[model samples]
Target: MSTHALGSAKLVLAQNVVHIDPAPAVFEAMKEGWARQQSARFLRAASITPRLRLIERFGEFTGQYPWQWTPAEGEAFIAHLRGGAKPIQMSTARTYEVTIGLFIEYLMDSRYGWTEVCGERFGEGPQAVFHEGNSVLHTIEYEGDPRRRPLDYDEVQALFDAADARPAKIRGQGRKGVLAALRDAAVLKTIYAYGTRRTESSRVDLVDFRRNRKAPRFGNYGSLMVRFGKASKGAPAKRRTVLTVPEMDWVVGVLQEWLSEIRPHFAPGRHPALWVTERVGRLSPRSINEAFVNARQAAGLDEDLDLHCLRHSYITHLTEFGYPARFVQEQVGHSHASTTAIYMGVSNEYRNKLLEASMKARLGEDWE
Candidate 1:
């Protein structure tokens, strides 16, 4: 008969496995190995800890985790979870179920270690166990419409003003104050002004700005070439987007006076990217989020000011100013008119006024 060891202390036979006293280091290694496997599959790092905790907690009573679970044990886990007065959300439960299923599936793949645990020990494959676990998880039900609470113009403006008013505090008398307000204001402004996706907002390069003599020079009016996005693998490359003159001028002026001044000092390698690392590298999405957090806290703004909100606000601002939906869609880099139609629904007052004007003109009131 074939024999194997589950861990340093546990010996597996065709029929039974014997356990010996195992050090915590062995379990920790197992946990790290599991984390690595999941991470390799593109699971976010933020999710790894929670999934591990769930498995550990379940293991405390069951002797083994979901990966080692049988159909009866899977059912027992469900009962244990539902026994609590406070029911967990179906979405949350589903997430855990998926994690557990993946673990079992990984073990059964034969490539991992299935040759050691097949029909001789467990009658079914890993996939069979995963299906059983999924069936139990699916019984959980949640009832509610998706919640969406979009911000109003005044609320958005308040956030902007609050960002502008943030104070800087640091140690020592001569120490430069934190430019929290300015930074926050710039972040919020850029989000709304550009209608940028979060990834795009964080990735925008300084080279996107260029001189345009044909645009209006008075007031805050200048054009900017926005790096919209990459083309498909075989598609032709697209030209950079030309933003509204007013928005471009505002962004350029602030960046030139502030970011430009500070760019050289920390940029040891003099990286050409607009958002560079202190030692000269590209600014990561994490850095952008940190800046957002600082600005939000300083301005006393609510948690609703997410990066995607800027894209919504961009569409809203354009529609409010009487720009055509098609024109707005093009500027925002959306290919669908239906996607831009959401902005049209935001202001019924504008639509009503337009309707009244059309009616009056049709009735000959303006013809005279």
Candidate 2:
């Protein structure tokens, strides 16, 4: 009688097994849940694909189905990653842990019916494997690599000089990319002047530039209406208008020249993109990054300096230029003052200048 019962259980297992080789139905159901998220607009295809890949990788690492997974298995997988020859960074490990945790949560959710399906099929069900104790914490305020810190004032000047010289050098050689080089220079300057992210810079439209009442000299280039500011998860794009400051007012003439002379040469038609490409379309973020890379190399700057460094430099420079912390935060579209502080990489010289002025005011000329 016992032998017959064992045979019956084996037949049930075999029938239930569908692509995972152990339990294909569960995998199919999990995929359907992911598809539901996509349909609900909770995630874009670009975001969904990578997360699905991560789930599959976790499943392969555990060598078991999701229902059979445990906290021990999840811990072991993270340990394996840390012990690998090319171990992942803490941020990357945290992302992996979060993705796995979310997947497990999906399976355990009663609304999806994964729990009941697993319990009936395997006499077990999924549970949360990652918890607060084992997960990484946001301990540090500034987690970005030190190598990618903001450029100093001299370095910013050198980078801009290199960008400006590119068009001149190529034009002297009778090269065909003079217009492209000019576009790159203007793009970099606009990003720095406006403290815009690469995507924001790339997405700028001619009509986005508005007149500032206080800065009438800048005309239509007095402020920028950024329609594509960074958004929080599952939220629409945030919008902010970055006003042109007195110190960076030189950008007004640069933009004027680009709009009147250089940009017209691109023949962008009525596309309205501020930065036009050789193809007469809006500049892409990838091209913006490439432009920065080329300029950094030409300037003999640090290899770690990326296009985002330009924004960091802008934030730090504004702080040094006597702008209040709250003002800087608003200019960069950061929701918190702490976020703006993280972007600041102020120079020692500026700090010293501040100290000197403060000492003179407090000592009443007694401070030498």
Candidate 3:
């Protein structure tokens, strides 16, 4: 029978509804139907595969199919996840709820006719197991781990110094990874210099660097064309060009050294990538992450500090350097100024300096 024929099965509305026994073929057809509907919406296979698996796992958990699931089953599954030996985080739980909720919504859609199909076949229909009361509410702007705050100025210096010393340390040990070490240092510096995400840093092309007319002193590296900005749900990747401010002009020298002296060592023939791996291909985000991990460990910095801390440091340092909120927001490609604000972890010293400046201005006396 055609896929649509399953949904058009006859329905019984008697006081005691008789349920049709769901065959294996019938269950497989429903799964295929959901997959087809998701594919029609143009979702990537990478996104669709995990969601399909999530629904299947949920079905297994309740010992029932989608049409037989109830809100109580969902609540029990969530409780099990939270009370297990390896409890999932709130964000993770929220994502699970959202994914399952979307699947249920797709089934309940009249265009798919899964609800009618289920009613006729099993005398029931799928209900949205996740609701406002049961789901996690997104009440905070920043819900990331508290340990993942921006690095302080001293810590930033220590990290950069550690990165710079890596090649020398390798050479001293009679190792031959100096070029790779240099590449790592350059990548780490570029990440902080532009406040770029890890994927954005990995995706940089040599030609993505543009000369800024306003900052001619920076030469051809005055602005970065970020082609892989964070994308919204079901949307194309966002793009933004971050201009080189005077404070981060040190990056210009680093880029020049890498292009003219170091990157050629990798023998990157005709490749457009700014960061090339030892294999002469474009660097991956995983490699970028490893670079930061090595440097952070070498610096003896906080164990909790990760690669993203550099981006946070950039946003905080730029704010501390007296740049306007909107300028920093645009540079970091944050859709909202509030997002930029959330990334900032200004030091107590900086806060006191602002307070002192305010007091001096009001009292007409120098506070320093």
* Candidate with the greatest lDDT versus the true structure: 3
TM-score of 2: 0.89
lDDT of 2 at 177: 94
CA lDDT scores, all candidates in order: 0.56, 0.84, 0.85
Model 2 bad stretches (over 4 Å): 1-22, 38-41, 80-86, 172-174
Candidate order by decreasing lDDT: 3, 2, 1
Model 2: clashing residue pairs? none
User: Which tens-of-lDDT digit does each residue in 218-314 have in candidate 2?
Assistant: 8998899999998876677899999999999999999999988998887788988899888988899999999999999999999988999999999
How many clashing residue pairs, candidate 1?
A: 1
Question: Per-residue lDDT for 158 in model 2?
Answer: 98
| Residue-by-residue lDDT tens digits, candidate 3, 1-368 | 44443322221112244336544444556666666666666766777788888888888899888888888999998888888789887877889999889878877877666687778767999898999988889987677778899998899889989999999999999989899999999999889999999999999998999999998999999899999998875567899999988988999999999999998889999999999988988899998999999999999998899999999999999999999899999999888889899899988889998998899998868555
User: Model 1, 1-368: lDDT tens per residue?
Assistant: 41532321122122242336322333454456567666655666666778788767656756863335575665566567767997665565556566666655655555445434444334533333446424544542332222323345776677666566553343234455344334445656766666666556666676665555666562232444556453432243344474653533466565655575655555436455656654466766666666666655655666755545556767876777777777788877665687566533366777787888888889867643
Against the true structure, candidate 3 has what lDDT?
0.85
Q: Estimated TM-score per prediction?
A: 0.56, 0.89, 0.90
